[model samples]
Target chain A: MKKLSILILILSSAFAYAQTPEEKGLEIAIEADKRDQGFADSSSKMTMTLKNANGDESIRKMRSKTLEVQGDGDKGLTIFDQPADVKGTAFLSFTHVLDADDQWLYLPALKRVKRISSKNKSGPFMGSEFAFEDLSSREVEKFSYLYLKDEAVDGEDAFVIEVRPNYKYSGYTRSVVWISKEKYQPLKIDYYDRKKSLLKTMTVSGYQQYLGQYWRPDVMVMANHQTKKETRLDFADYKFKMGLSERDFNKSSLKRAR
Target chain B: MISKMIKTAVSCALLFGFSQVKAGEWSGYVAAEYRGFTQSKLDAEQFDKSSLSLSFEPEFYHSWNGGDDSFTFVPFARWDEHDPQRSHVDIRELVWLHVAQDWELRVGIDKVFWGVTESQHLVDIINQTDLVENLDGEQKLGQAMLSLSLIKDWGVLDLYVLPGFRERTLPGKDGRFRSIPEVDDHTVYESGAKDKHMDYALRWGQTFDDWDVGISHFYGTSREPRIIPTVTPAGLRLVPYYDIINQTGLDVQATFDEWLWKVEVIHRSGQGETFNAFTGGFEYTFVGVMDTAADFGVIAEYLYDDRGSDPAVAFDNDIFVGGRLAMNDAASSELLFGIISDVNNRTRFYNIEASRRFGDSWVLSLEGRFISAGSMGGPFSSIRKDDVIQLELARHF
Candidate 1:
């Protein structure tokens, strides 16, 4: 009778710990999503620095804006701002289901807009070795998550959650995310491959609040373990609630925009 | 011409296997170019003519390993209008190729050119060259081969055998129209030595962190030297006695940090004579942008005809130095500029070309080639220059 009582007490404590982690992780993920969902009042521009294993580096300036509708799925458009050859080129993302997404690019020389098929979503973009899927939306439903453990991140109490991709076509199979308990923001993420091997790691830093209720990360760094390549994306000058439309995302509109 | 066309069509149809029609698994494109030449003051229309260049390459692939492993075949056809404007269809490469996890094999007629030099000196056994008074052309093709390759973690080794075909010979101006002068008459045309007729070749390659290394060797007859003839030393002969058959060769290439280097050495011995030749060069991309890249290449090559051993063949030594610039855009256009310096006479040959890939169905190209032959040899050998321009369009299905 005494042993049974001890076992029941242990089980209850374990369940309590599990609930705390899931709740903490959901808070961080949801808070970040809410801030990233809105369109900017004006067009925003940012510079990104990508470093490779050989110590080579590339810098890309990008212009991005959000579309009008909140749930229409075609929510964003990004254009390349540097490199004379690929300048004025635009990429559109649509059909943003939790499972699959569609994207396209308009090339100036060919004077044609090409629909990028799903089969090649995992391949490198513009021969830079970064997969197209890496640049897409990371919807919450795209992964199945479970709280792993409690840890200290950036000198703050944090909850670590393991997130596994639910779709077969995803380049990474699993990722471990560390969320700070105080701010409910991601500190670091370790991405895993199909072989269950660690492939890449991403770390977020310098979180800044915008528009009183919204929080934005100043920078995010993604590094490929095997290739020793790294990409640093810097976000700045963020605005909220701008009006954009589907017609603005069309191929013909790419030429007129600055 | 008709027979060559029929053979080429049959070979292409066989290599492609006609499966794309049923499986719906193929995509392709076609290209062509045309050229017209103005006769030099030294040689009239006899050496100059309007020429057309057309090429068709149909590619086919069969998937295996859940589509990871595949068999890819690219068979090409080229038609050129030679002097006197006889149409020639060169079946450049037609082979059945297979690529798996660890093996690659190719059988049938094909061209396997290995080297980093703009002008191949040692490993150019599969093409033929045409010679004019002021132009130097050596192109090799239409040879049958069986090759096997094994892939390793860091490198690959290829072994191959070639049968029935070789290089076309060009004689020195002094030794025109001689029959097997530097080679044996019997071996040149006897046709029964299948044992020695088969050419053996081996190439091994390894890629390093920032460089690639390759070594290859071939034992066979000289593709160019088969006929022989006796000629007097002169400054104005057109067709020289082509001898020096039964040639063996070795080639090497190394690519390092955006730079490519190559070397080739050839030795020929047959029917009482021997000669040695060597060539080397390098290529590198100097300018690379988003949609375009420019490659600058240069070569210093030498060919020694060592007729000093057999006075009967009677020849003079010749050397050449050249450079070429090739610029290409990712989408659909390319431009090439080339210059060759004839060391024997201090003359020069220059060529420029521009080509565009049109839609998915056709391609168009324009080219201009010029050659300046100075007063190098003959009594009437005044400064002669030939300028040629061309435009062509081609389609494929």
Candidate 2:
């Protein structure tokens, strides 16, 4: 009888060692988040192209600077440089973990800094297929993950995970992401609507290593299945560790963001 | 090598007193506008209801000292088909800015706007109004000043020393939108130095959580001129009288969820009598309504002024309600409509403005204004026939 009890204990210990899919998913997310850290600050220029169902296209040019805030989310400033009507327009944001972000908009025509509401998550950004929430910094705590399975995406081994937004304001019910197994970077994401129907698909490509450690995507294209519209973001040269500080992200400095 | 010599040359030029500065970039827009009035001109001396105008605003910018110091210049001009007074030119901005670790210094002619309410700007007294540009009073001529701003964790305190003032632009007798009795270009000032009288202002602003507050005081010549009707040598004309005044203002804005609340209050002494005026409003926005990719915002504000006895200033007590629609599309189209109605009388004003980007470098804008010309017989009596629909197409570079 004593030998039988020892065998049962051994079996129970083995079962405990095997993690559930949720736990495994969270472990992968933590690893991915860890790899993206230590980039003190970054600056980049990007162009956004929008295409309608009829294949009509429009382009936007902008420059962005981001500063990493220790123990919290990042601070970002974006200045619009093209589409002449919006030239010199600037936007400033301070993202906080588990708290609402602070946003400010600077309009060249008004020549003033105005505090804006950050709760408009479902709204499109710059008339693009990307929603406002999609452009915000993605913290590990913002979503809950569930490991679906392992799949090969475009002949590359990747892990498929389903993630549901933890925030209440997100327009997406859930999203399915394909994370490259080797690089721990996202290769594609499928967003679902409130009715649990697929709404948009985003594919990322052209990964470039920056700072000898950081992996950044050169292009990300988001397509809306419902409207048959698409928006493509083409990133230009990205400079990391630009020595940016808190003073550069303040509202008063928005007028000089360029 | 060549690069090292060029770097040394740049450093030497910087060491000297800017003997050679880098060439600045130029950018601006040229707009052509057409205005069609709904009614005929009110007076025999007025011009035709159909009007055409062309406007240009060019900007030049240069930066140095690792971007800590910079200079900006913008010049604006307009050419009217009719009314010579409407054809004008002014310096919009020509300023040099220096930024230090905690403080910033700005000198030269600059355009500064200070107000929170949407119905009217009760505390925005930094620049003179370019009245001839439009009756909506959204344009201003630059004022020369030296400003110092101390930025601290607690708040931002700004001090200004204004040395020169630009006279308010008035409409000519032939102008379509004009108050009866043509205004005399000559002006009388209570100050001994006239337009050169020095002005001083200071403002302290801070943000707490979701609220932003600003308190300011200005002791200078009032931007609004008192139009005193008198029989001049030419005829019965309105003479503009400038007065030195002391004004204090407070503005606050609170942002919560999808709602924005704003209020601006001011107390002025030296115009005619000491009085207090206030304007407050709120805006609530709905995003992604009706399964469409558009955002709609509803706004309402109350305007109050105890100086109703003054005939020159209207909208003493009014309620303004408005709506804004932003179509989230590739064209980036937007529309704004508002109505301001006097509480004491039947005076009401309706305004509509819409704009959309055409391509990479072009935009189209439309504006329309309608007035009821109610019991308020001040400026409304003259502008009753000035209801106009304006369209502008601009090409930017």
Identify the candidate with maximal lDDT. Answer: 2
**lDDT (CA) for every model shown?**
0.54, 0.86
The residue-level lDDT of candidate 1 at B99 comes to: 51
Q: Evaluated against the true chain A, what TM-score does chain A of model 2 have?
A: 0.93
Which candidate has the highest DockQ of all? 2
CA lDDT, candidate 2, residue A248 = 87
Second chain TM-score, each model: 0.66, 0.94
Off by over 4 Å in 2: A1-18, B1-20, B233-235
Per-residue accuracy of model 2 over B268-382 as CA lDDT, tens digit each: 9998889899999998888787878888999999998898867666778889999989998778899999999988778889999999988788889999999987864664878
Clash list (residue pairs), candidate 2: none
Per model, kept true contacts as a fraction are 0.00, 0.71
Q: Give per-residue CA lDDT, model 2, range A18-113, as digits (tens).
A: 878898788889999999899999988989999999999989999999999888879999999887778899999888776778899998765778
